[model samples]
Target: MQPSTLDVTAERPTIASVVRSARPALGLYVLFQLLAFGVLWLLSWKAGVSPGRFVGAFDGNWYLSVAEHGYDQAVTVGPDGMPAENSLVFFPLTPALTALLGLFGLPLLPAALTVSLLAGCAAAWGLFLLGRDLAGPRVGILMAVLWSIGPGSAALHLAYSESLLVALVAWTLVAVARRQWPLAGVLAILTGLTRASGSALVAGVCVAAIVAIVRRQDGWRPWLGGSLAPLGLLGYLGYVAIRTGRPDGWFWLQGGWEMHFDFGRFTWIQTLEGLTSNESSWITVTALFVVLAVALQIWAWCTRLPLPWQVYNTLTVVIALCSSNYFQSRARFLLPAFVLTVPLALLLAKLPNRALAILLTTGALVGAWYGAFLMAIVHLNP
Candidate 1:
């Protein structure tokens, strides 16, 4: 006699089921990162370049110095004993981590590499958690893989804060989605301390909480989540105030670095003025892309997607546009602006597998190039 058919609907996936589903995809993601790293390394080697020499460029050196020596306001003074401005420019987190790594007997550069790589891996896991919550385990793993092997992968290899910031932002979103308000808030706060644009996370969380309250859907939990999100940001601001005798010490540092945020000013005009006639075609293309990114954010806002994602995307766009430095490369700065990715991801979810794979593969290639190029330029210039 034939056995009766088992009803699939009767069996819901447990935590174990979810993990089992995600494991293979997650493994593929790790393999992708390894492959990307190898490819980049080969490119550098083909150019007869040493990774150490390339890594020695730009903000990397300054960060290494900060790690070796704790921050000193006096360092802001020049040889003439006047405030040189650049002295007080660097943020504290990267260097602090470098110092911690020294306890393990690692040199500054190696420590930075190790930290960036670890942070990248952690970020992938966090992104997986985020995607898992919003979509399914399979999509989550795919998103993580895309992020790790994409153009942004180069940021993970450099001594920059991109990896750390990505990890913090991803985990913060994960915590928020899980309804762990305090953890979310704390992570958001740490993100703010990590980068100036990080305040966007706090604003997003607050807006989300407010929406929940307005709907009268579990007020206390959302309120608590919102309230806790800014603590890391506030703590850092407090430190700046105590140290520099101004609550807005960080803002002042930004201003000193010529990164003024003037919303009403003509961003396009300022960007054009900064470009030279002889600059590469890539520069002009990138400038136009930044302008388009700003426009996209405005369009997204008008279309009225989810309020939290809207707020997060809008704030990041505004910050990028109003930024005085590298306004032309706002696209690069806004790479971690993942709220914009939500709508895109939703759209991609409906596509055929072949189409989705093509789109993701192309994005990953571009992301890897951009991430590496950004690091290379910064290292060379700094």
Candidate 2:
């Protein structure tokens, strides 16, 4: 039998329906943000730190500097006439957006805040769309609300690339599901430009496309979409190389920052032994968390879920864990950790309304607390 065209009147919910459907999730998301803000404020007060102190802290300074001044290879050199890894660390997208926003007379801090918030909202909307595609409209709203209230949401308030990246990835996945190959590829490429981990999306899409080709599924669209995923990432890396007169300049910079990926492979036993030491408690904890996340991905894969979604998520977790340069704070870097929510959403759908409400409330509290602590640390230290 021929597949019927999607009925818009049947699939698209009314505005009133969407709002009424989203109310519970929206309320919970707001509560999550408020709680996070309150907790962070309290922590800052106790630590004798001001909330403003956290505004443009950590890597935010680098991005702001890059926005004010375009790329200069000389900027990578420190007082010792040696290139500092952190100097070349700026990614193109964030600074470019900052510069664009500055045309309107907005300061860097405010611009960052505005862009991040908008990106975050866009991400939530994308997640909602993805959920609606994969599960149902109700689940879609739940997924969006959960994402908005998750620990990762804190990235929106920072000058980091997480919010923008999440928005791109979520929408890219949505496009993939709809078989909009070119759109998926375009978003995937943008995602690559957003962050290093974005390469995982490229890989995932490419794999999915290859699988489709091998199985003789719809051909041209998948191939085109998959092919475009790595272009933005590779193009930017090439630009960095040309500017630095070193083909591997980007890789070198990542290494200089001690983000080396080979430590686990080259010194496996020693790495494990070191991690067991008291001084390496943080490393041990991070390793454990990464392992747990990887395990979750494996479980998802084994469960025979949708092939494309499974591949996308599994690759993301693998890259986060096995990639050469590992950071302890990377525990939160698993922003794609929201993939776990797919299953969680399904489970919640089957639960009683009261139970689902309780679970969402608990998740919001945890997410808020995590976000607050992250902000405090980044601000106070950086």
Candidate 3:
């Protein structure tokens, strides 16, 4: 197959130019983030918990630990005798960025928070670029706005790695779509270091590169990029293997945490049960979102998304659904699949101005409340 027709053979915009063009999207993103934080603050006040504390709860604390002290030498076991929270399960890039910021004497928490906030901005900008290239400037702005109001966007404001991961994933996809092979490869490497879900990105990049090579397009650049794309993930996995003296050290670590791939069996069972059970709202809400996400994937397949985007989005949702991890966390896991929002954004863009404004505003409010509820009320990882 030939390269994507979306490939840009024109001169690339400079960083400053891209930032200048992305100002509106960035401004809207900041506003949405502030609104989300405001909702979280009010909810936290009612719940008698500090908003800052809530943002950095659960996985954020582990990220902070890795930032401050690096990974522990031995895994600690919980009272139930399972291997306790291990920083190794957490990727390295976010903590590394947080630690780099901590060098300026900021505390670990603030450093991690700062890293997330800045990365959130970059993610918004990158999403804008991706959408603009795929559709138009209006869709680009909507893409950023939609991302800012995502149900899992609470993690963006938190000391979590989602912001960094999405930023890398967005820009890498843009590079791939534009056939900037070398840049795509570099970003894919960093993305691989950001999260295990980044494997989806690595797969997308490799697929695009292979397509170009088969068609004798882009010369040897695709070969180089595809070869470099997997290094970061393999490097980390190799380190773990050497450290643990096991070929599947990463999977072993995950198994200890009760996080293993079950090919959607666990998700299917839990989702059905959660939908019918009168358990916590978290389960019901999470299950509903999972169902909606699957529906969105079906919708996306019927749309005209490019091959790489299709591959990336499908793999991301599949990974999120197929994992045996915490069921409630699956929604947050789907945060990186931004392409799934394109159809909704396109539909919103077609509405009359007033109606569109009302719809987006309503979505932002509901999404904000959902995020706050997930964190403060349900007291769960988001």
Candidate 4:
């Protein structure tokens, strides 16, 4: 029987079909997350450490503190009468979601982990969409896999807020790519509320909006979305100003943690020291990651991806590298810059299936080892 041309045309794939085809990427994302999680748990147990403590330490503890007790009205003072670190430095959305889950009878730690798991999955889905739209379905799946096994992905399974921010940023970018301006703006607002990196997302949205406006496309929506984008971050900063009675209240509070943008001066100095001098293995490894991140960013730039991705990735790396935060935490700070993995994914997608499987397994195992090591052995924040 001969098929009519109209029938063939009607059978052409739709947008919904394309989206549904990304399920394997989402499935693989969940698989690697669980596998790495199990490996870390076993190693933690073998080392006489509690898995809960491993996942709930460092910034996780601060998030738990915020969940249990809301933010302090004012920053505390140290013994030297200096402003000390307080819950205000932590973003509110992660802990707020944790506390909301606690109301449903889930324990605090479990609730926090639940938020991470859900947000991580959401982030993976959005990553798949971005990669798929940018290149193809294979690139999309590979991007998800690369991100799952990327450095500092352990935080995706922990109580940290990186997953939440990544989820928002990914979907916001996806929205921008699809010209869903209002959705992009709403997600940008949420991203702003999630962390200081929200500024990067807002900047990306504004750039996309501005481009659309200049092109005379999408009319008032771009203006509306762009106008709404920064409000969440501004609102939070304004609230902090009211609380601290200073115009730079957010920046002032961040001083307690020694976190500020310094145009990469601190990073360059510390990285050079770690590479040239006697440093702990972890410190040397961190320095190597710093180098690798910069190289990857350069590679991503050469790919000449979309403007939103470029803006977001550049700002994210700049924020991570230029900050005076703990050097060991720089890799973790870059986890949200998933676009940097796109170049790697493109290269890896050319491999035959069996070879690709072996390489991916090896990468996942290394990621698992690093995750366990950081959580159980290293005393510093990841």
Candidate 5:
């Protein structure tokens, strides 16, 4: 007897599953990105700003400068007597890619944007891989879509390190989940090379390595991988130290940019100021998301997310949020904290098609508009 149509359709295909059945997620990510960027480009055109000027605003300009000219002398100083927006604070990976592209005769800003766009796609693919492993194909697609349209998502398209860092971090975590220690180590190193948040990835890998050792898996691989995980971050810091001839040069340079880590006291002050001050409502919006992120970190811990993911996500949020100033960019900084989306993805995955469509449609519309506004109206770059 032949199988019924239902049985036949239900049986998974064997020969061509398309990257082991992640095509849907990849397609969805691409679709959402195209739609959102199309809207942003339309807005930029209306405002008479070119894509390069619009996308490579703020730190994008800094990265481009670093790529073209390398680090400049720190002669400029702000009122706080700190280094003023120097290039030393940025990690080398994204800028290095931009510089390499420039060697092929590409313009500096365009090369940075190209690197960011490619890295953003990679990040989306990695998110799909991890999301698929966590749930199923549709859930994975939803995760990718949500990320592409999430707050600060457009920063993925801009010349920011977030794109490459997220890609490296997501794939690193995926490797951790798969117990591929060597791969995880390499990605973790690259992650550290991409952004300061690479510290979180290194910590996550260390946690995973320790967990493996505690589970009685006697292996030199775990120790060796753990040892290599932090080299990218530590090595960069060492380079900065030598360049500045100070053990604390990086932090001092960040201070010149009106940025510093103050152990959450500064964040609490900002939150309180936003809540109490009436000069602007957007301040409160930033505070709300900061609070929401903290809550989600707690919620993730309570949920079934892996220990490594939990550690990494929490540390990333802590570092990203508990810093000095830049309240406007807090939401953008939270874009790659993909672990926070797991519970929402699980809940959305079980919803009816109509409900899921409504929720995601709302998210896409709102996120795209908000990001465009940030990209166009303010000095803030998404």
Candidate 6:
């Protein structure tokens, strides 16, 4: 008899296969980032400013200030007896890491950009791994590329926390899929340290744990991990409570930054206004994407997204839309809700290779154009 083509004994994929699998998507993402960088640089050069000065120009500057001088140095009181601009509202890790990079003689914006670039790459890899585990390698590859070039993806490659937050969310979900409860919870805690949005991760873990308990799981790992996941968020709140001598002090800081919890009434108005008027191109773009995201959210539910992912995505959208200010920042805020890539990835996986390549290239061009618009027109560090 001829030797069997398939061995009875199977071997797991080699590390090389894993790396090669992620490379195309990551390479595509990086290519677009470079393209955007080139366009933004040319625009900046014409405007008599170095592109380096703009990486962290908006919130990037805020993080740099937080890194260089402690939050206390940033407290200027408004006429209404509140902080006019407060650094405490921002998370600490980005600023802290940027400060460390700055100590090595790099300028703060450059250091922050370095941190963002590295984190964004990790995020792409994590998205690939998570997508592969959820569907298949094809879906995973598409998911990573789609997310890296999605609307408002400029935020992912900028000096902002969204990149790192998505990186943490992706890996935590990967750990969850592997049933590595402790690792998932630990990453969730780190996610909390990265942003207020970390609450979505904690919610996902909690929902997953509750379901596990209801199903009579074998051990306490789920509960233990769930318990561990909220510490990073609570720890920061506790610190603020101590410093300000008020139980709601951390929340007050949010108000100082003009971010108030309003149950999303204001969000609908903002969306409707933009959808109805041509007052601001950015607002119109934001409204259109939010509509697309809502459709994706519906698709996720119809496709039965796992309970944990569902919980995370639902809570993220709720938290974001309920916030009272910074309507234009909606794009930046929603970019980290990376689970929305699922439907798009599924669709893209159905395309023939050549068509997929053309579609991806077109998406990259759209991303690069929007990145330029954000840099040159919106005057915001996406």
Per-candidate total of colliding backbone pairs: 10, 5, 0, 0, 3, 0
- Clashes by residue pair, model 3: none
* C-alpha lDDT of all candidate models, in order: 0.64, 0.67, 0.85, 0.84, 0.78, 0.78
lDDT of 1 by residue, 304-334 (tens): 3445556776787778677766543555466
Which ranges of candidate 3 are over 4 A from the true structure?
A: 1-4, 10-17, 76-82
TM-scores for every candidate against the unseen true structure = 0.79, 0.83, 0.94, 0.93, 0.90, 0.90
What's the ranking of the predictions by TM-score, best on top? Answer: 3, 4, 6, 5, 2, 1
225 Cα displacement, candidate 1 (Å): 3.0
Write one digit per residue (lDDT tens) for candidate 4, span 1-382. 1111111112446878865887888788888888888888887888788777777778899999989988854577787765688778787889999999999999999999999998988888888877776667787889888888877788888899998999899889878877789998898888988998889899999998999999998889999889889998998888888888888988888888878889999899889988999467777777888999999999988885888888989999999999996987888888888988988988887889899889888888777777777777775667
User: Across residues 1-382, which tens digit of lDDT does each residue of candidate 2 receive?
Assistant: 1111212234666879766665655555556666666766777787688867775777777777878887764636567555676545567787778889999999988887777767776777777766766667676777777666654455556676777878888888767766678899999988888887788778777876787788786779888998888999998889778777789877767765556565245233434654676365444544554555566666555553445666667666655555554354454566665675666566577778798778877876665555556556433221
Strongest candidate by TM-score? 3
Q: Candidates 3 and 4: which is better by TM-score?
A: 3
Report the C-alpha displacement of residue 50, candidate 4, in angstroms.
Answer: 1.3
RMSD of 2: 4.5
lDDT by residue for model 5 over 1-382, one digit each (tens)? 1111111113444646636676766676667777778778777787778655677778888888889888775646667666676788888999899999999999988898888877877777778767766666666777777777777777877778887888888888877776778888888888888888789889999998998878856477788778889999988988898888889878877876678787878778888888788456566766776787788778777677677888898898888887877778888888868888877777788888899778887787677767776776554655
Candidate 6 lDDT over residue span 1-382, tens digit each:
2121112134557889988988976887688788777877777777677777667777877788888895764345678877565677778888888999999999888898888888888888998987776667788888778877777777765688888888888888777766677888899889888898999998898777777778777378888878889998888778766666678877887767678889988778888988996598877877787788788878777764567887898888778778988776776677777778887887788889999989988887676666667677677655
Native-to-model Cα distance after best TM-score fit, residue 91 in candidate 5, in Å:
0.5
Once fitted onto the true fold, the runs of candidate 2 whose alpha carbons sit more than 4 angstroms away are 1-31, 73-82, 149-153, 215-219, 263-291, 323-326, 374-382
Worst 10 residues of 3 by lDDT: 1-10
Q: What shift in Å separates residue 294 of candidate 2 from its native position after superposition?
A: 3.2
Worst 10 residues of 2 by lDDT: 1-10
Give the clashing residue pairs of candidate 1, or none.
57-379, 58-382, 150-368, 151-367, 151-368, 152-367, 185-228, 185-229, 189-232, 189-233
Better of 3 and 6 by TM-score: 3
Kindly list the per-residue Cα lDDT of model 3 for residues 1-382, writing each as its tens digit. Answer: 2123464866888989988889998998889889999999999899999897777788888898888888775855567756654678888999999999899999888898899999999999999987777677777889898878877888888889999999998988888887889999999899989899999999999999999999999899999899988888888888778766778877777877699889999899888988997487777878888898899889878778778888999999999899997887887789898888988877777778789678777878887888898778877777
Residue 126, candidate 3: alpha-carbon lDDT: 91
